[model samples]
Target: MHKQFSDVDTVRAELLQNLVDDGETVTNLGSITRLEVVSRIEEVTKKIISSLSMEEAPVLTLKSRSRWSNVRFSKLVGLLLTMGGTVSTLRSDCPSTVMKFALILKALSAIYKLVQSDSYVTKRDIYYNDPQLFGSQKTLDTIVDDISCLLKVPRRSLHVCASTKGLISGDLCYLEEDGTRVDCTSTVVPVSSSVSGIINIVSSAKFVLVIEKDATFQRLVDDEFCINFYPCIIITGKGVPDVNSRLMVKKLWETLHIPVFALMDADPHGIEIMCIYKYGSISMAFEAPTLTVSSMLWLGLLPSDIESLGLPQDALIPLTVADERKLNNIKKRPYMSFHPAWEKEMELMLRWKQKAEIESLVSIAPHFLTRVYLHNKLSYGGWI
Candidate 1:
């Protein structure tokens, strides 16, 4: 894609001019080493020490990630905290922020030990280590993210990880940090405990399928969906996904350069889950660079397919008040404008006020998902 410039900075600057155009997925700067992680931590600590001695208040400044004022929607990056979003300073002297400041330091200290030893621990593990000081898991989680953003490094880079919540099965194989070779071909494995340490990834899969619910994921496995299909990988985070699962999906897409697809039931929540895999959520948007998969295509169980498939209307569930409200919110999302096909499916769901689970298709025939529905979709290019 480089036509003229051979210099790295010049090429990067030229490419960045349109980096966020349309539906391009954002990528992180790359992995940081143990020494670099330690160095950054020391540097931040030194800055705070410098601030403590000076007229400065030893405050930690970071973007207000939770507030809507900090979030903006872009077709290129989904809903993310803008570079110029509202900033809040955590002051060491303020009574309100003193505990918060202590928590940040505590997290940093814990990170220093982890990086120094090249050890990995989950956020839950860190919380349990000093629950009294952390107060709760949420408190620990927040500070970890704050430290991550402040250090301009991913949480995983700090050696803090999420507890595994997703399962994967497919033609993929890889070696984890401890040099454990995992072959998902024979059995479904939990997503890597340390995604950053994974290496030697190999896969012959033509595509990846992200499932909404674990029950649905298991159902496919029982049907040998992985064996019979177009040699694809399947993953599920149960319902709402954790960071590791998102990271795995991003990694697979980047490495394989294969089409990624999402299959959710025809409902507002299902659509939202699909969006989370395709476009990063506003809550964790700061990590969008490493989490989102913009190429993820909407696969089966679409609302528009409900009538045309000739499925029984009697079994279909009518949308509840909450579902209608959620659907409206989904339609209004700024990224929705870039996806009229998705929007049309959503509009149809709202109009009919009916929803169906991916399981609902099973009534047509046993193993219909692998045997018929998904097969047709993948074979004939039926995905959106």
Candidate 2:
């Protein structure tokens, strides 16, 4: 009462030949329901799997009615081998060939399971290599390290739940061994004066003043000059701003709409430091555009000030060849392209190969700064 059907290979060959004869490129074949066809294919695959010494079993190919069909069958067999533990054994026995294939298939399966399952792996568990080499271990480890360091959490127990029914995004909390929840982010502790001092200044200041050297700030404070200035905050030492400091400064300037003024020495290094503060230092991981002062407002020792102060000619700092090239290259910048005043300053510096410090000028009489000499002649000309 039943009609005989061809085996998988015969059916596949027939289908392919039919495609070639009709000049139709077979994109796919309809769902295969024939029991005889499936049985024959399964038998062939089982024989292939059994024939290869466990070491070679993973690379076996299957005959199918279409390319898609072959791919699906191969994946299915790989899944089976992975689940059956034969894949791991084969990998362990022969590492170079079978091991790599098994590891790849297992990784894919793990990822698929991760996506499909309701339970999610934490950012910590996924990173830790306790299980074995899996999906992007190095990348995962680096991410975990960064988050742990930034949030100041112990790496061993840090875990973040996926946004489900109740959890908020980016909320890192602590979890116990038995999965009890503790709100680490909620506990408010006393804020340090250094942090609070900066915050208070940000809150009150119309424009924040950032000074590089501690001694300069000390001199300003000691002289009791403009101590009533609410918004002026000084950064001590020569180091670039850290992440927390950069973020705080950016938030004050950008979010609060406050202007920022930076004071530093007049040398190449000082200029570079100010630029880095505004544009972000390459060494530090932090970046914020709002934290920089305008280069046009750069003040300190002008070339004329150096000559007028009667400071030793030897006090002028020398410019390297690289510095000369950098000065010349500034002409090409969109913001600073071709200023005669800037060119003249560069020419003077190159001629003498000397650099001047802001402290030198700051150490001079205030009358000199306020009256007889301005930081830059260009400022007086209204070119800035």
Best by TM-score: 1
What lDDT does each candidate get? 0.81, 0.38
Ten contiguous residues with the weakest lDDT in model 1:
1-10
Please list the residue runs of candidate 2 whose C-alpha ends up more than 4 Å from where it truly belongs after superposition.
1-206, 228-231, 237-239, 255-258, 281-286, 289-296, 307-314, 320-335, 338-344, 362-384
lDDT of 1 at 321: 99
**Cα RMSD (angstroms) for every candidate in the order listed:** 5.0, 22.1
Q: Which stretches of candidate 1 lie over 4 Å from their true place?
A: 1-27, 55-57, 68-80
Per-residue C-alpha lDDT of model 1 across residues 83-102, encoded as one tens digit per residue? 66688888998999878888
Candidate 2 local Cα displacement, residue 78, angstroms: 51
Each prediction's total of clashing residue pairs, residues at least 3 apart in sequence or on different chains, is: 0, 4
